[model samples]
Structure formats: structure tokens, C-alpha cells
Target: MALAAFGQLNMEEPPPILGSRSVDCFEKLEQIGEGTYGQVYMAKDKKTGEIVALKKIRMDNEREGFPITAIREIKILKKLHHQNVIHLKEIVTSPGRDTDDQGKPDNNQYKGGIYMVFDYMDHDLTGLSARPNLRFPVPQIKCYMKQLLTGLHYCHANQVLHRDIKGSNLLIDNEGNLKLGDFGLARGFSHDHDVNLTNRVITLWYRPPELLLGATKYGPAIDMWSVGCIFAELLNGGKPILPGKTDPEQLTKIYELCGSPDENNWPGVSKMPWYNQLKSPRPLKRRVREICRLFDRHALDLLDKMLALDPSKRISAKDALDAEYFWTDPLPCDPKSLPKYESSHEFQTKKRRQEMRQNEEAAKKQKLQHPQQQQHGVGQTHAASHWPAGPNHPMHNAPPPQLSHAGGPSGHHYYQNPHGGTPGPNRYHPNGNQSGGYNNQSRGGYSSSGSYPSRGRGAPYGVGPPNYSQGGGQYGRGQNPIAGGARNQQYGWQ
Candidate 1:
């Protein structure tokens, strides 16, 4: 069945050349892997003749034409050039191509697509862990753990959060230096910012208590939890410590090993949105011994601190790297001197292609099952005719347009209250008016007072006008649109 699927994949086009104006610098060798939104290929540079990996993304799969996560990764990678993180070389995009009835490229065909170029990595941590004859000694394990922490520290130091930290995302070079890969789940943090409001990030297995409980406001501590799990996995030959089939089961496993959390351990535990419903107040039970018996007592101690039930008490990545276990005699092996594995690339390629075929088949089944729905899934159509380009269009390089309203600055206008205090029933505008352009007005506009009506009274003070509507404010007449010195305040706006 897999062979038949592969045979149907229209391989006639000689695996689209990497440098056909759609991409430069690299020459396509073979398909290596397929991600949720893109295809990855092994390629070599045309100019430097250096081997590299090229990732091609289908614009149609992204609502904004480019995935925001992908954009975020690129932005973070561009600024973070470190030895531990994967290096991003360049980005290329090509216009859509016109093809003849026979599917051959027509002379007038406009070729356009998006491609990302990255440094070539021989294998990932998952492959290494699965090798039958390979046994990771304690010293070698320590080296990998230290390297992982070093890379993690680099990310955290730069105020970046790697929400997804797992073996598959850890890339290995020929020298065995494990560099952190996959910034798709990373987010930048601003100093003084307390919590992140996005709870739906990170894989379930590696997710921390804060995330599993639906706490949007979290911190780097979330990533630290995953690091701890990765550390345990490295020590135990790549086995997850708290592997669970469901969210509740996963939390149960975590509670069993670390014991239940409390205010004493996690000061802000009770304040979390899901705090009341969790089993937090229950008596502590479960022993760490049942998890991994081979872990040395000192290593177990470090793991205990790292996998603390209370995020506030969990050891930071920096602290974990400094643990005495790492410095003990028979110290960690140098990454450069590690032994190399035989060709696993072909196996990886075949496995990835099979997964891609399965995914495509599943997508086709979904389409057939939901024929009544819109023919194009949320982001399926890629034809240029359906994608209109404008200044505000996500694909365009122009800034969003400015909007104006009566009684406010012509540059950008919004409705406000006349009482010079909170907005009244008649002073609200349902649609938002901004300097760039008008958003759904019914959604409500920012107040000159610099508070969002939709946000609770105790909500953190924001910089610009309120983004959404909440309490006290109503939809109606636009007044007091400009607040005194509201624009000059630079609090949450930045």
C-alpha cells in the first residue's frame, strides 16, 4: 500500500530543483521529511558546495499566506546566532508558475513559492536514541544534557521561550554536538512581563502544569519543565518520564512523581484560572523510585528539583547545567569527539515519505467526508486569482492603512467618553478605529483613557486605546476620542 501511494505522487518533475528561481544557494538531493506545513529536503549549496537542508512551505496552507509561527521562528533565528541553535542561512520565495495542459512549465508561467534554507544536520536525537547497538553511557548522557541546557540558556537569556522541547527537535551534527532545532514553538518575552496569555502552545507530553491547567499567563518556567523531561529522557535512554494517554493522566503521572503542589511550593498556584478544579489541595502521594531506578541518587535529586510540582520552585536551566553531577569524575564526553553513526538518512527519508502519504490520504478522506463544507479548507486554495493583494494584505510589504474619525486626530480616530472618566452608554463605538485602519468597530475601539472596556477593571494597564469591548462601555456616539497624554504613555504598547 505504501509503495502504491508513493507511485501516485507525480514524481515525474525530477523533484523540483532547489535553485529554480524558487530557491537559490542549494541544490535539491532528496526529500527528507514533511512537517505539518512544509516539505523538507536534503540539498547542497550551489555557490559554496556545502550541504544544507531546504524547507518549502505551501502558501495555500496559511491563511495569511505565510504561517505566523514560521515568521516568528525566522525572526527569532535571525537575531539568535548561537552555537547551540540551528543556523538559518537564507529565505527564498518564487511566484506561482504557469503550466501547459501536460503539466510542464510554460514559458509564461510565473513561478513563485517560499523556501527556507538551514544548515545540514546528519540526524536527530530520536534516531540516536533508537539505534539498537548504541548505548548512551552516563558520561555521554551528561554531555548531551549540558549541551541542551547551554542552548536552552541561550534562548532564555535572549528572552525567548522554546515551548516545544523534545528529542525529535534536537538536531545532531557530524561532530555529535546537539544543537537545538525547531523554533516554530518559541516566543519572545519582554522584561517585566509576568505571564503569557497563550495556553494552547507546546505538546501535551512535555507541557508543564501551568499550561495543562489552561493558564495563559506563564513564563520561561514552562520551557524549563520540558527541559527537565528531556533530561530524564536522555538519562533513561530516551524514554518519557510521565508518558500519558490524556491530559488528566499526564497530570496524574506528574503529581505521582513530584507529589501534589500547594501554595507553599507554588505561591501563585491558587491564583491560576484552573487552580480550583485541580487536585492541588489533596495530600501528597506517589514515589519517584517507581519512575526510573537506574538514575543515580544525585541525578534523581536534580530531576526532583527540575520537575518540581510548583513551577516557581523548579530549577532554572542555568542551575541545572551547574549541578555537581555534571562535574563529577568521568566528566561528560566532549561533543566533538563522539563516535559517528552509519547511514540513517535513507531510513529517515523512507519513514517520512510514508508518513506524508498517510497524511495526504487522511486529508483526502476528510475532504470527501465533509463535501458539504466549503470546497477549500480554511487554507487550501493557492491560485493567484483567488488571492487578492492589497497594502493591508498579509503578503504585501506595505504598512496597514490609517483610519480617521470625527472630533479626533485625523491621523487615526476612535470614539471616547465625554465625561473625562469612564465611557458612557452613548460614547462607545462598536467598531474600532485605529491609525493603521478600522477594525471591526462593533469589537470596540481604544479609549483615550488607555483602558480596554472588555478587560476587567483590575486588568493590567495597556498602552494604546482598548483593543476590545468588555464592561461599562457601550456602543454609540463617539466622543472624548482623544485622552490627555494617552498616546505618549509607553506601557503595554511596546
Candidate 2:
């Protein structure tokens, strides 16, 4: 990936170039903040006469081409249209002057580009948490937690996993509506695909225990673990629940607070890659009261379920929405009803624009001063063979249909009997058993051509598509089932 090249060699290419002229419908306002990969600016939509946020990514430092994370973030945002998630209006790729002499084209111009257009928002939850006088009321904190969970639930249901779930990634609009942004660490899962080979994703601070132990075949449970940490942070007034300088230290802190995992609590805990090397000497036996004396009992109870060491036992997004903590008092306000401000309290909207222009100029100067690093010819060869497929790959399609609208009092009610008490035809018919036109295309050892009939019942969870069907052939026993069509018989079981 281009990112890999940037890290491996010292390159002197000017940082990615920002477009001189804003897009047709938007007028560049001001620079708000700078990030590892790019700078953010406030822009006004000329057509709608509304303000929006535009992030410009620098590609000059990149060795191969565009960063994979950026592409992944864009893909996830384009398909996800939710109230609690940030909206991506458009992506602009424009040419500008090149800073590095060696990388300059015959015309002495840079080939790098920028991305423009996004919904404008105020500060992130991280900044809000740092304010000393802004003691958020219980009702208000609950409101934020509920919105965060709701957004997470939406992402999980869509089969999109957000590896990073921190305060900085959560943005609050002027109306105080919290939306999930920064999909740089997000990944999409599909039933038909095998697990990827990489285990390097997510920020170290919010990583789940399973990930810390090096388990690669994880699911939405990984994300749930981070959400649990964020919940604890909220209750503690922005203090991290498990703050460690390194992976081992973080695990030790978690064990100290929640108690060590035993066979009964987590069946496969001992077999993880790093399990033996960093085993905790003390087992966790403290009650919730000892951890945080000041936390509300009800909120603490929810946090316990979310932070469960056993991924299987962790509370799901659907179940979390039904928790009593959310229903007790100070109900969440509608996203559209939150307060909106014309300008940020820290920086006047106009001044921010001027700074952004200045930053761009400074970036160009820095690029010109640095000596250009030689590019390996190998990058061009690798780029063609490993060109990233856009968002439409079969393996990257929408998540399996969720059991939406089951006849239950709450969304969590379906967990009581996840299978709905009816087993369907044996689509995987054992060895040599030709039950459902078994002799078709081969996947692993099973026929991929056979059609599994889908049985449509009332929505099982009131979130995803209705009814579970046996679609993707079994990758292994006890493996998570993938979604199939409505006509396939795999629908009846679970």
C-alpha cells in the first residue's frame, strides 16, 4: 500500500496538494485542525447555503499511491447513510504544484490530490470531555451514550466493524447530536469471505482483550469491547478505563479492575497467542462497587455487561438499547432537536479559513525544502497486481440481513431463543448426502451452486433483514452464519 511506502523510506515529495479553487458548490472557509494524514477546513455549500466540513488529504509523502485506510474510510461512509454517522457529500481529486523536485512532472507540477466535502460539525467528544467546567448532567451523559450505542448498532447491523471507537472519532454537531466519524480503522465482513491475514488495526488504547491476545477470527464482538471502554470513560468524566502504555500493561490494568479471566468465563482464553506470555497473577474478584464508587448503579450495571471479558457473553448493540439505564430518566433528544451554533466558541469561522490558507502555503514551502527521496521501481509493479477493488467487491457487500421486528417487547428479547425454535432442511447434508442438489460448484469441500431456500418470518431483532438462512456454506462448526437469499431453506434454523 502507498502508506507502507511512506513508512519504509524517507520521501521528500511535497505533501499531497490541496486544490486552489474549491468545488463548484462549496466555498472554502477556514482551517479547523490538522491530522496525521490531512487537514480539515470548514466549507460552505453554495447550493444549499449551508456549512460543511472538508478534509484535504496529502498524497505526496505516500510512496505507492493513495492510502488504503483513506479508501476504506470513504467506502464505508458512502454506503452508510445514518443519522448517527457522518455523511460524505463528495470526493474531489484535483492537481496542484509539486514540492519535491524529483517527483515533479515535465511541467514542474505535482500529481497528488485532495478530498473535499463533508458535513460540518463542532468539537469532538474528546475535546468536550477535557473541559473542566462542563460537567455533563446524568441525563445528558446518558443521551450521549445512547446515541453512541445507537450508531454502533447501526454499523454492526450493516456488517461494518469500527475498530476504533474513541472520543476523538465521535463528533458532536451544533445541536449536540453525536455522530461516528473517522472510519480509518473500519473493516467490512461478509459470510462468504475467509478472514483476512492482517491483525494490525484499531488504536492500542481501545483495543479489545481478544485482539490484544492476537485472535484474528473475531466479529462485531471486537467493536463491542471498545464501546464498553468508551462507556466507562463517559462515566469517569473522560478518564480512560484501561490506560496502559503498551499492550501487556493495558491487559494487566484490565485484569486488575475487572478480575482475571478463567476457563468458565472465557473458554479459549488460555489458548490465545499471547496468553501464556502475559498471564495475570491475580484473578479479578472485586465487585462493581469497589471499581467506581461514584458511578450510578444502573449505569455501572450496563458497563459490566459491555466490558465482559468473554466476547460471547458481551452485551450486544441491540440488547444495549433495551437496557434500563437508557429508559430511566432524561431521555435522549432527537438528533434534529439539538442546539446549533453559527460559529465555534474557540475559533471564529472566518479566522479559521485564513489559517487554513496559510497552513497550505507553509506545507508547500516545507515540501520544496526537503530533498526528494528516490522511488523504488518496484512500487509501480506492485500497484498493478494489488490494485484495490472499489467498494463493490462481492466480499465487501452489505452485511447479512438482521432479524428485524421480531414479535418481542424489546430488541434484546430474541436472545432468549436465538434460533426461533425451528430447524430447517440440512443444507450442508453430511458426506455423500445429495439432499439439495448437492453436486454444484465447489467451495472448500461443499457445493456452492446449490440454492438454500429462505423462510421469511417476522423480523427476529427489529434491526436487520428478517429471518436467518443457511446461505454461505459452513466454514466450520460453531462459526458465525452468513446471510443467504429469502428463497433458500437455510432460513428456518437460525
Candidate 3:
């Protein structure tokens, strides 16, 4: 009884590690990423020779020693322990050039490079999805989804909100085990009646309706919406569900797919400032299943509940784990049994991102050089949207004519239409006598413009049917004449 009393009286906080144990402890490798708050590096621990990711918390001009956000994240991550959650091993400070010969850290003259060491991950979800060759089978996708939900369940149970949930924040090792990462936007909640949260936490595409409508008080439902969006993205060729240009357009896109919100559907939606202001009462259209025909009924049902317009009605993570989608055919594979992908995801992502940066730089230079001439036309960049409907389309049910192309460009390689003549004064024969994308003077399709795409696939870039020609048979001045013209040229494949 006396020892217990003495221990209770003498309890104290652990000593603060004001400096690193040694300057040469970690071998600094190449920088992996740079963000608004800090930079991450791939480093090696000299003592253990273990590879790790070191995130440098930037404390450039703050009179305060360490960043408050960093401190908060560290505190929260230390309490979390799960197979699907990133592990924070330790925190250490790197001594700057101002240190003495003995490598003692000097706070006054030293640049504080406080680092948070984390478990090494081979790739992020975004990088893995971006790989041209790697494909996520149905079982693999289910496995990933299960892991994500499991991690999110743990966080919500601990009263922590992972406000920023996106593909890039999920890390995966070589063994196909996925782990939740990027705690910079995470926040802890106290067990009290009042809890205030910022609405501008998630990425624009993954944001839910409540948050988009300026909701400041929210719960785990906010994350469930992101899970739905991520699931949809995984099924739909790794593209965002709602890619809108502006906030209003984004809301409109949501309404178009999920049906517009009424007070009965989404309680308190009419009170939102953005409700009646976006499109002045457009009709609600529901076509989510039609758009995502790849998913089965059970998967669709789970996604519907997860993406409910009413936040109160959204399914919780624990509930989602019990959905019938998981117990269906093509059962979720074990993480260790999943296919092993190359660790080249990081390099490929960096290369693609660098190329995109270069393209943006080039576009900026072009705009600066000729703002008057080429004023950012979306039609030129995205030609697929403007292509004619397919042969089976209701409005375009006419059987197409047999078409062929040669391997050379000439001054007069005109089409041999049913009119049985070279393109001339009478190019328009309205009665089903049309040839594919015409006005050809070619060794290839376009000499001064567009490249001649190779054959093998059926209709390279949705090459229009033979009946796409309008009343005026002569190709117009601004016409896109090539059958399989340029589309998403920046990305390597179709």
C-alpha cells in the first residue's frame, strides 16, 4: 500500500526528446514527395539497416519550435495500431550544420529538421491504379475495399476523423497489404455534446452532399461517401465519378446521377445556401446503375447506401463490412495471396507527373505566346465527346458502309463513295450514300494536321459510321476529318 501511494504521487510525464540521438543515425536518401506542409524522403536506418519513409516537418519561420499540426498528427497516430493502418515508429530531429564536431545539436543556430519515421510502403493506390499494365481483379478490389473499411472502422471507433480520404492516402506494400496513411487532415473528437468540424476537408470529387452544402457538423458518414466514390472509381477504369469544373457544376453532376435533393430526401437541404441557386430547379435524373453497369446488384445496393444523399441514412463502416457484396461469388482474397505488382509504381507515377507538369508548362508558354489564337478549346483536346453515335445507337441505326485505309499519303486519295467518284462538286448524296470521315488528300488521312492511326482494333477512336455526313457533303472548314482522330493524346493508350 505504501509503494502504490508513492508511485501515484511521483508519476510524471516522459522526458521530451529535444534532440536526435545521433546525426548520422539515418542515411538520407532521395526525396519521395513534396507537399504544402512538408516533404517526405526514403531513408535508411544505419543501426537497423531498415528502409523507412521520413517525413520532414517544415518549421521555417515559426517562432514556435515544432508545427502544431505535426504534433497533433503524431499524437493521434501513436495511439492507432492495426494491420491496415500506417505505423509511426519514431520521431527524431536531424542536427543541422550548426552542430559542433561532436555532432551535438544546437537549437539556436540549427535548422530544425524534425522527422517522423513511418513504415516503408511500396506504392500508393493512385500510383498503382495509374500503372498501364497492372489491373485490379474483382477479388483484389474486394480485398482492398475490405482493408480500407476495416481501417476506417478502427479510426471512427477511436473518435478520430480521417477527413481526407482519397486514393493517394492509401499505401500498399509488395505483398498486396493496403494501409491507411496521410494523417495531416485527421482530427480527434472529445466525448462531448458539441463538436465542430470544417466542411472543406475532403477532395472536391470525393466530397459528400452535406459537406458540399456547407455542413460544419458531421460524423463518419462523410468518410462513407468517399468510400463509395473510391469503390466506383475502382470499378470504372480508375476515373473519378464526378469530375466537375466548378462547385455548382459539381452539385449539378451529383443531382444528375443521384436524383435531386428535397427536404424529404435530404432533411434540411432546402435550408442550404446553395440549394435553389445552382440551376434554378432542374429535373432530377437517376442513371447511376446504367452508367456503372459493371457492378452486380448487391454491390450496387451497398454503394447506394454508402452514397446516400442524406448523411443520417448513410451506412456505417462496421455495417458496410457485413454487406452481401463481400459474401458473394469471387470472394475477397487474402492479402498475402493477391498478385504481387512491381514496385515500379512510384517511378512510373513520378515520370507521368513530370510529363504532365511539362505539358502544363508548355500550354502556359503557348498561351503566353498566342493567347489570341489558341484559347484553350476543350473540343480540340477531347474529340471523343464530339464523335457521332455508334452504329447501334437508336438515332443512328443505319448500317455502316465497308471502309478501308491505305498506308500512304497522296495529293488525291479521295473516297470511293456509293456515288462512285472522287470527292467533287456533288459530295453530298443524302440517301444513305455516305463515306466515313472524308475530304481526304492523303498519303495518310491528314498531311498538314492529325496523324494516321494504325489499324487492328475495331474503330480506333470511335470512328464515325458511314452515315455521319450531314446534308452538306463537303467537309466544312473547321471539320475533324480523320476517321480515328487524336483523342487523349497525352495518355499513352486509348
lDDT of each: 0.55, 0.55, 0.58
Tens-digit lDDT string for candidate 2 (59-153): 65677877776766666766676667877767765455422212333232255456656666665665454443233445456668877876777
**CA-only RMSD, every prediction:** 26.2, 24.0, 21.5
Model 1, span 1-494: residue lDDT tens:
22212102211222223334446445676665554555567666677666767766545545555567666777776666566787777776645652222345534222466777777777667555544434466656777887787677767766788776766577776555667777776777754667555876655556788877768766778888888777776665444566554556667777877777677767777777776677645667646655554567667778777777677778887677556666554466655456665433323623633455555556566556666554566676553333323222121111112211111111100000000011111111222111211112222322222111222212111112222221120111132122333321311111
**Considering lDDT, where higher is better, how would the candidates rank from best to worst?**
3, 1, 2
Off by over 4 Å in 2: 1-27, 46-49, 98-109, 191-194, 286-289, 333-494
Candidate maximizing lDDT: 3
Candidate 1 ranges beyond 4 A from true positions: 1-25, 97-111, 280-282, 343-494
| Model 3 TM-score, all chains together | 0.66
CA error at residue 263 for candidate 2, angstroms: 1.8
Query: Would you list the clashing residue pairs of candidate 3?
Result: 408-443, 409-442, 409-443, 409-444, 410-442, 410-443
Q: Looking at model 2, report the run of 10 residues with the lowest lDDT sum.
A: 408-417
